[model samples]
Target: MSPSVLLRWALRDSARGVTASWIGGLGYQAGLILLPWCLGRALDEGITPGDRSPLLSWAAATLAVSVALTGAEFAMRWWATLAGVRTGNRLLLRLSERVLGWDAVTAHRFSAGDLVTRGTRDVEQITIWISTVPSLASGVLGLFTVLVVVATLDPMLAVVGLGTVPLLIAVNLWYPRRYEAANAALSAAHGARADAVEDLLSASTAVRGLGGEQVLVERHHEASATVHDRTLALARIAAGWAANAPFVPWLATAAGLAFGGLAVLDGRFSVGGLVSFASWMTLLGRQVMMLTFRFGQLGDAWTAAGRIEAVLSAESEMSDKATSLLPAGALATDGVSVELPDREPLRLPDLSVGPGEFVAVVGPVGTGKTTLLRLLARLADPSTGAIRYGGTDLRDAAIADVRDTITIVGQRPLLLSGTIAENLRLGRTELTDGQLREACRIAGILEHIESLPEGFATEVGERGSTVSGGQLQRLALARGLLRGARVLLLDDVTSAVDARTEQRILDGLRELDVTIVFATSRTAVRDRADRVVDLGVHDGELVSHG
Candidate 1:
């Protein structure tokens, strides 16, 4: 989807609100024209003739119009705000849904910072544009009305007022291309700065331990300087435009005043008519200036929309076709090979494990044990071959169904910043408290959890920082278990737990009647497995021993 299409869709979605805002704006503009007309009427029929009754009547009418204008302005603002918020929320939800549908590998191409900027800051810019639409529309309507009113007072003055339109258009056309280019550069700088900050924060501990703090700080400083330079450049362009925008309007006002004065002196115009024409010209000038400013803002908004549109239109790693759910049978990999970026292919020998079997995958470092588990979990598709559940190829199975039947616990588990129960029931929101406790007990972390001040309700600080390493692993295990998946893939889950805890966890697993495939180097864990597949062989043979 292009930005133009996205913006059109948003407008359609909030059509009713947007229409109401435009109506209110037009009404307010009409009221503004009435105000100047009333002043001219008071001057012509009552003040100059010294008639108290007509003057009082005109004064009352002006007051009434002022009140009506206030109400119209209020309505315009209220509906515009509603339209902006509604459209913004819709865009945000759509972006989130698109992100969620993306496979792990595809999603990894975007950094957390970049995604955040697109979803938040970019969305805000579009919303700001939506809100300004009513104002711009009203300004145009008001400008035309002022010109028409001036023409009625004096045709010569109207011609002078109309001259400003082309100049305003020229100013807008000249500045936006330059302003937009600057805004795009500024936006890139901001995103780069955000990425640097996010990278530093995510690896703060590693940087500190490796004595690379200064290095990272310098990198961040460079990113910040780039952002500052871009921002300064953008500000300079805006400043120049701002200083030049007023000149067109000023020139129009001066010409209208001089023309109207000559007409009045030549007995072709009344004093009241001259005042009314000048008032209309002044209002027209203000509207043109406002339009020019909004045009600049629209340029920035367009750039932001384009960025968001790029993400929304990106292709997902997985196909969108609906497929059958995985059936109960052996899990097998045939001629499976995975080639990571800039790395040699890790090929796995053809192997199959019967349903409900416990298999241990053993391999030295860089032998692709974790990669095998990731492939099984559908994190990434094999580059060369197919993985099958039962007789059906994994690629033909629905991705959501595959995920529901198979869950993986990574070596370094990530816990969200929430209560223990909340983390455990991340995806399985329907799980009861009792089910949560049972899963935790089976993972061998229930005792530690119960000892906490709030037990299941205790808040686990960001990334589970409040818990010990062992506890974090167990919590993740519990979360996967609570999903009730038929196939559980554990990638060195017991690496952090002590031997006794690992034994207990393995013992509890034996009673689940589910297929278990885990990668580990622990002898005890291998000893407990029904079969072990070694990946340490030079020829990449299965080397299964029972």
Candidate 2:
């Protein structure tokens, strides 16, 4: 999507709030114009003639207008803030939805830190533009209001006010493109720095083992230096423009003062009219300054909008037309092949497994064992064949239905910072406590959990740091079992456990009435399976044995 389309989408999402904010801004600008006019009326009709009663009446009118202006300004601010927050939230939701639906290959294109920055810092940049819209609108309306009032006071003074408009327009047009380019560069640098820092922290152990801490530090320093330099360049441009902005309005004010004063002396203008004209010119100056600042914000927002659009516009791997329900039976792959970028294609022989059979896939490292499992799980699509379950192509079935029917446990178990029960019920929240414990028993983790101080209520630290590696794997197994999927795919899930523990876990798994496909290199694991598929000697082929 283009930046314009992205901006339009954001506006559409927050249309109601934006419309209300515009209304409030219009009212605020009207009040601003009226305040100076009321003061001028009091000076001309009452104060000048020394009429105490009329002067008192006009004074009270001016005070009332000031209070009204304050109220209008408050309303404008409130509405603008509401619009900004709502738009930011909507964008965040849309980005998250898109990211969640992406296939593994598509997701690998973005770093975790980059995605976070786009969802947070980039959204905030866009919100800045949305919030500033009302102010920009009010300034524009006020500029016109001032011009009309000044023209009424004296046509010559109106010409002086009008002179600033073209200059301001020229400055706005020239600055935004340059400023936006600089801002985009700075944003890129910042995202890079964030990614480097996140990587360093996440892999601190490996960095220390390899003694590459200095290398990572130097990389982060380079990214930070780029950001600092870009920021300085952007600041210089802003400073230059700001220094010139005040001069436009002040020059107009000087012209109005000199000419309007002479006009008053020539009996063509009143003293009150001259004072009102000067005040209007000053107000116009302030409007120009506000618009200049908003224009800069607008430039930054455009850059951010483009970045966000790139993510939103990416093609999703899942098919929207896949609405058929997946049936239960045998699983098969026909002429399956996967071709990754710059890597040789992995082609598998035609294979089939009966429903409820336990099958083990054994292959050497880099033999595409995990890739085959991912294909079967629909985490990726095969480049050249179809994966079928129960005689129906998975491509024809709804992705959500297919995923609901299959559970995959990766080599590395992932657990959130929550109680053991909480993690077990993540996939199926309606599971009773008895069911949770039953699943834990089936995964051979019940005794371990019961031995803990809090039993099932024990808190797993972030990423399951509180648990041992083997325990973490067992917890992941229990969570998957709770889902009760028809098919279970495990990728070296028992690698961390001892042989006896691994045998016990396998024995428990064999009792379940479900199809199991596990990849392993251990002879004990392969021997336990009802059938085994060997990928170690056939190049890309699969040789099966019972």
Candidate 3:
């Protein structure tokens, strides 16, 4: 979606809250005019005329207005908050789903840290804007009320009223654009810094092992300094606008008061009319001030909205259709080609697997083994390829249907932060204790789980860091098997484990009826595979063994 489209949706979602906030500000602004009128009346008929009765009555009226304004203010705030919170949630969820739906190669194309930043930090910026932005509309309404109140008291003062508003508008529009440009720079610098930090965090051990702390630290400092300069530039713009706004109003109000005083003395204006002019000028000054503040908020929101739009606008690698059921235990790939940007495509010619058949992919590094496996699993699509299940092409097949029949365990296994049983039951919610235990046993992770204090309930740290690499791989295998996929793609899963462990895992998988396609660097490993295809590169293009 475009930035404009995203913002339109955001506004619609938060309309109720935004409206509430507007109402609250209007009520407070109404009190601005009413309180001034009450004071002017008391001065004219009570204090100046030495009438105590009128003073007491106007005092009670002021108190009642104050109470009502307070309620209005609170009510508006409550609703605005409600709207903002709900909008944030919906946008967050929507953005997250889009990002996660993208393919592995596509997902990795964007920085993980930047995505996290957009989801969180960038999202926060809009909330700040919402809190202050609706005031602009309310302030305009308040200005109108002030002008009418002045016109009723004296038509002469109303003639010069709002003379400075055009100039104020020009300044508000100009300053915010400048502020936002600087903020854009600031946001870019911060996102770069986040990417750098995430890179370092993920490779902290490697960096420390290689004694590259200084290099990382220097890179971090450079990123941080750029962000600091951009932030200061944005602040400067805001400061300039804020400092100048008040002065413009001061000049306008001063001109009105001096001219207004003389007109009254000349008998062209009344004492009560001059009182109204003073009140309107005060109200106008505040309105101008609020106008400047809202401009800054909108500028900030515009900046944030653009970044969020970029992420949400990102298209998935390929569109997935609605879920449709495909038959069980069948797979095929016909003249598949895996295309990488700025690189020649990798080819797989006519590979098929029957129900209960085990197949393995063997090739050199950079060969199409892993790529072929990825295609079969639909983790990534093959350019100019036909992947079919039973008699239907996978492209025509519902995405969920394709996924339902195939599960892949990648070279580097990922385990969610959960107990062993919880991780195994990820895809299958209906797994019984016996079934869960059986899958774990088949994957050879049952012994490891039994060693832990909590057995199957033992907590796995973030990404399964609490377990050994061997254990993580085993857990992944258990998850795939428990899903009962008719086909399983194993991509160098044994790379982190010993030969004994690898043999045992393979032995268990060998007895399964489901197809198993494994990629391995060693010839010995491939020899044991049910079927092996050597990925031979000729003329910088790949050809499989016939």
Global fold similarity of model 3 (TM-score) = 0.87
Which residue runs of candidate 1 sit more than 4 Å off their true CA positions?
Answer: 48-50, 538-546
The TM-score values for the models, in the order shown, are: 0.94, 0.92, 0.87
- Candidate 2's residue-wise lDDT over 1-546, tens digit each? 678888888778777777788888887888778877877788788684645998898889988888888888888888888999989988999999999888987898888878888888899988878888887877787888787777777778878888787987787777777888888888787788889887777666577968788888887888789878998999998887776786788898999999999998999988877877777788887777887888888888888999899899887776654665445688888999988779888887566877888888988898878988888889988999898998778888888778888889888988998889888888566799999888888778888889999999999988898898889988998888887789999988898888988888999998999999998887878888888887776743444556
**Model 3 whole-model lDDT (C-alpha atoms):** 0.75
Per-residue lDDT of candidate 1, residues 1-546 (tens digit): 667888788778878888899899988888888887888778877684545898899999999999999999999889988999999999999999999888877788787888888898889998888887888888877877787777667678768877776877777778888999999998888888788898788777777878788777887999999999999998988887876776776787788778878888999987777777767766776777687777777887889988888889877877754676556788889999987789788888677878898999998998889989988988788989998888778788888888888899999989999999889988667899899888888899999989998999999999999998999999999999988888999999899999999999999888898899989999878988888888887645443446
Off by over 4 Å in 3: 48-51, 131-133, 151-160, 256-280, 322-325, 340-344, 416-436, 454-457, 507-513, 521-529, 536-546
Order of models, best lDDT first: 1, 2, 3
> Lowest summed-lDDT stretch of 10 residues in model 2?
537-546
On lDDT, the leading prediction is 1
**TM-score: model 2 vs. ground truth:** 0.92
The clash tally of candidate 3 reads 1
**C-alpha RMSD (angstroms) for model 2:** 2.6
Candidates by TM-score, descending order: 1, 2, 3
**lDDT (tens digit, per residue) of candidate 3 on 1-546:** 545676678788788789878888788777778887777776666564656787789889889888988887787677766776778888889888888778886687668877887888778767666666566777778877776766675555655665666777777767876887898888888888898787666666667868787777778888889888888888898899997876665677787788889988898875665776786787787777777777777776787889998887777766687646455646777777877788887777577677766556665677777788778888777788688777567767667767778788887888888877888887567899898788777777887788888998899987888999888888888888887777788887777778877777877887787877777775545656656555654422322332
